[model samples]
Target: MKDKQVLEFDLIIAGGGAVGCLLALSLRSCGLKIAIVEASAYACDSQQSLHPGFDARSIALSHQSASYLQQLGLQSSLLENCVPIKQIKVSDQGHLGQCWLDHRQQRVEALGYVTSQQQLGTMLYESVKDADDIDWFCPDSVSDVKQHQQHIDVILSSAKRLSASLLVVAEGGSSPTATKLGFQSQVQDYQQVALVANVKTDHPHEFRAYERFTAQGPLALLPNADSSFGLVWSLAAEHRDTFLHMQNSEFLQQLQQAFGYSVGRFVALSQRNSYPLALARLARTVAHRSVVIGNAAHTLHPIAGQGFNLGLRDAQCLSTLLRNTVKQDGDPGAAPVLQVYSQQRHQDQSLVVNSTDALVRFFSNNHGPLVAGRNLGLGLLDLCGPLKLKLGRAAMGYGGQNAAS
Candidate 1:
């Protein structure tokens, strides 16, 4: 029998989703041997298996996120397929309070860009695919992980042994690997479900996004590159099945009633998909030589569209620390290095998590006073230029880094 050989690397990322792939791309110039172990096949051809995190769904990339990708050297190839969101209109259903945020007013190119998840994922994967320093283990996953004094050892389901100086888990919420590694997450169910679909309107989108707060939940219509609107409608848990299975025409009618005729009439609808909404987070993100990031560290409500942006920031911060450590020829998984990452991410993570949770709870109700208050606040926000500027900056994911400047 031949002796089993073990592959070694400076870092091993356990998830090949958007976050993990982006992290790998961010570290391409860091001169580290990187391994990405993904259970799903890195298949992009239409006839191949579907990638979970990079499905047919679409996502809004904040201005900061776009800048981060550009900094990672994906500007020319990526961003071309994205549609810019020049303006965002926020309002309450059947109320007079509303506000408009314009990219021109914010002194930036655009507030954000919308693109299909599959395109971004494929592009990131392509960029890292040919790199000599990066190795991909697709259709395989980390079945077991053990942390040691100097390095962490990983055992793949294929019985391949691997060793790494650090292990980063981006396996997402409800990750079995994270659970096996003794990471406990506190999950708060919002009792709501988000129904997402691509919707077509009778008129052009005009590069605008809308957030309408209905009594039941919040509905968002983001401009898509295909000249359609990507709809993310949050509804009570009980209504999940009804909306998911509703006739296309009826669904459009209900959507129109909730969103009004601001974006013109809804003419067509695509297949609907849904997932239960919740807030999940770990008390601590670092454990020994391993660290949890992306959805593994915190899963948030999508009310504010901050979940992915927040996860990307996690990758950005960790890569910064790891790159610096590599330059210094120091240990990337050292306790001090991991500690600094945890401490630095806590503030931004907490703010986004808490505020997203608050928005879900506050906006998903019909309390007379709260409704009046929020509407009034919206009115004031529109009237006050400074407040509008601050909100726009924050919406652009500038809470930590000032991408606006």
Candidate 2:
């Protein structure tokens, strides 16, 4: 490649998904030249467009994550389309164990907010689209990543080469660039698939989220802005086809049977989609001048709805470190800077990943002893103020000090 033909940037983000976009916006005011290479075309304005990351799926954002976005001047745009989650009710099917968490108890207006991925993507894209320091390379993907001593060379699908002082991979768990760069990940299949769709109920949701653990797996119903709920039902791989192919009424019946009538009857449902559940984490987040974040760094179970929240935290912490690096006239991709970012993120990532995995294993089983223990534990968690407070803080992405250290 000719020197002039190669584009140069201070930071090159490998994906244009939620995390990648958030990172770009987070560092927008840092005055560093940043480029985001996305495989999907720029489709932030329309939900009809098929973008891998910005889909019709609704995402739950922790209060802390919302605060981060607000800091980036996205509060007004996002709040218009979001549903505040004032309360969360968790229970096990056919069991007496239950726990309720209220935002009031935590002295917060809401525990979190739920918004469609499309809306969030639009907000993120609009926030940095016109920034002079940021370049969005949509409809292009990083085909290869070559790490050098001080910078990384990225080859795009368009046969264009770019050099950057830092290469941050925010691609999803199935990123080919991560694989081609020899980044090793520890993966565990939950033997389950998540069926997701939007459902209308007979009664209003009242901004309450429900987490019901059934014999098969966990099912979450997040309140939506239209008085409906976004359903995330985890089913064993063997039964996914049956549920997916069932008539709407049949599926609603099964969902009602499993979830009770907490939010009234499920009157209708949109198109359903399923994806396998797994716990995937890169063995190491930092490699030479490159780093991995978001799903590329750690992909967790959806039992607690922490996957995106955790990824947002990853972006937030990295952005803080990078901002400081720029202020100090240091290389963004230096080993010391990357190591600090990695260490700061380790605790938060491990806590959320392991806890989410444990929740899946503990709640998915039907063994009598385990069931009894989980029931007792839930009761205790509900009755214990300090324990509940700690759990709530963690869920809201405010528990760990090491995340900012």
Candidate 3:
């Protein structure tokens, strides 16, 4: 593209998935010129599944995440389709120790809300679709990036060139552009796969969620808006194929045997999909005039459901910093601005990453002593009101309160 043909903006966002879109929408009031370059072409209906991350997969939005979205004016639109998680029950299969969390104890209306990724994606997309200050470059991706002292240049897969004060990569953990930009992530392979599906049971979920840690791994059943349960069962990598290929009835039998009849019999299930689990985190989320956000910066294990919530906080913090920069008429991509953002987010990022990794490693094993210790810990947590409150606050996304936006 000719120099004259290169588009210009104050900010350029790579990846138009949930986190990217949320970041863009979060800055709508900042009056900055924004462009979103998405690799996948978005379809009118989410069922077509054209967008990569906006599939039927369910996601948990912690109370803090919901509040953040509400601050961005998204709660009213999303609440109708969301199923509130009023309570959470955690137990170790074949163990007597258990822990229960209730909204009443936490002093929150609900611990969190469960909604499909597609729903949140569509809402975020729609919010920015018609914004005068925002532009979309769908069906295109950031192929290369060059950061200059004052501005950054981006070349899209479609051969379009753009210049911006800053570049934010929200393309997720496996982002190619982030790799090209020299962002290194420390990754830990869990040696497990998560089997996800929507399951119908004989009894209603009643806005309750269950986390049952078995010898193999943790199994979670989160209530869905349709009254079905969204199931995420972590299995050893070697057994992934065996379970995925099993007949639905047989799989249900195995599931029932493992999870017990607490939620009643699992009668039917939707299509099953499996994702390899891993923990990926960048030591530094910012470099020069560019910054990495969302999964591109850190991807945590799903045991705590803190992945998206943490990313949302990244967006929120970055937006707040950029808005302040705008108010001061300063460059959004200035090193000082980016450094402050990285600094403010460091504590929370470490808390979630380390804690989630710890949970995965600690609970996924069947060691005789460790199992007993965890069970005892859970039992003590239930009996100890102060400790339980702390856990509940963490679960509600307030554990790292220092970085609150």
Candidate 4:
């Protein structure tokens, strides 16, 4: 029998989704050799069709997240395909409560930017392909991981072994490696599913985003570059199939009734997709020479478009810490290094997860007292300038000092 080939790297990353790719790219300047093992085949020409995470779904990138990507030298490629969100209009249906957040009030160019997941993933893949320090392994995955005193050994499905000083799992919430390693996650099923699609209206969005709380759930419309809007409508799980199977005209009519004519008439809608909403967090983020980041560490509800933004923050923090470790000639997976990363990320992760959960629970309830109290709170938030600005900043991923790595 022939001995399996053994490869060596400073870091071995599992999964090649946005978060995984971002981590690989962010660590480029660190001068450490890195390799990414992805289960799905990724071809530069067909990335969108091959990767499920890089489908037609749109993502809202916070200003802070854009800054981090810019630092990694991806601003030009990504921003060109993005639509700036100059303002956000938040309201409650059949209520007198409404709030608006404008970029001008926050003294920023824009609150956030919206772009399709495929575009961003393509940019990340292209950037990584041009780099010489990183190794790309697509159509491959880590079958098992074993920790040793000096390094971790990753057995690949292709019968190859990779030795790395540190193992980072950015494989997202359903990572098999995390499960095999005995990582426990705290999962809270929101009992809601989100229906996402690209929709066109009679009037242009004018660089505005809308979040309307309806009797069903929260319905969000993000402005798209092509004068359409990206729709994320949260509804009860039992009702999801009904809308999914409905004819386009009927679906649009129901959507129109739920969401008022804020952006004009819903003239058209593209193919619709549904995703179960849940808040999942790993019990422990770091163990031995391995660490989990991004969705693999914590997955948040998409209430305020915070899941991917929170993951970007995770990549930023971990990459920064790892870069510093390389500079000090320290172990990337050392206990001290992992401890600092975990401790620093605890507050932001907790805040986003809990806040998103609270929003979904409070806004989705139709009880009279709860409804009255929430409406009153919304009214006060709109009336108070300082308080509104604070909440806006938080939503824009710039709330607390801890959020900034």
Query: What lDDT would each prediction earn against the true structure?
Result: 0.88, 0.88, 0.90, 0.87
Per-residue lDDT for 6-42 in model 3, tens only? 8999999998989898888989968799999988888
Worst 10 residues of 3 by lDDT: 43-52
Estimate the TM-score of every prediction.
0.97, 0.97, 0.98, 0.97
Best candidate (score: lDDT): 3
Model 2: CA > 4 A from native: 44-47
- Best-fitting candidate, scored by TM-score: 3
Candidate 4 per-residue lDDT, tens place, 1-405, comes to 212577889999998889988988888868799999999887545523647778878889998888788888887976898999999998888898889999998999889999999888888877886678888787888888888888888999997799988999999887898886778888998899999999999998999999999988899999998999999999999899998889999999988998888889999999999999888899889998888888988887787999899888988888889998999999998889989988988888888887888999999999999989888988999999999999889978976445336
Where model 3 places Cα greater than 4 Å from the true spot, the runs are: 45-47
User: Which scores higher on TM-score, 3 or 4?
Assistant: 3
Which window of ten consecutive residues has the lowest lDDT sum in model 2?
43-52
Better of 2 and 3 by TM-score: 3
What lDDT, from 0 to 1, does candidate 4 have?
A: 0.87
lDDT leaderboard ranking? 3, 1, 2, 4
lDDT of 1: 0.88
Q: What is the C-alpha RMSD of each candidate to the true structure, in Å?
A: 2.2, 1.5, 1.4, 1.9
Could you tell me the lDDT of residue 92 within candidate 2? 88
lDDT of 1 by residue, 174-275 (tens): 887888789999999989999999999989999998889986689998899888998899999999999899899898889988889988899999999999
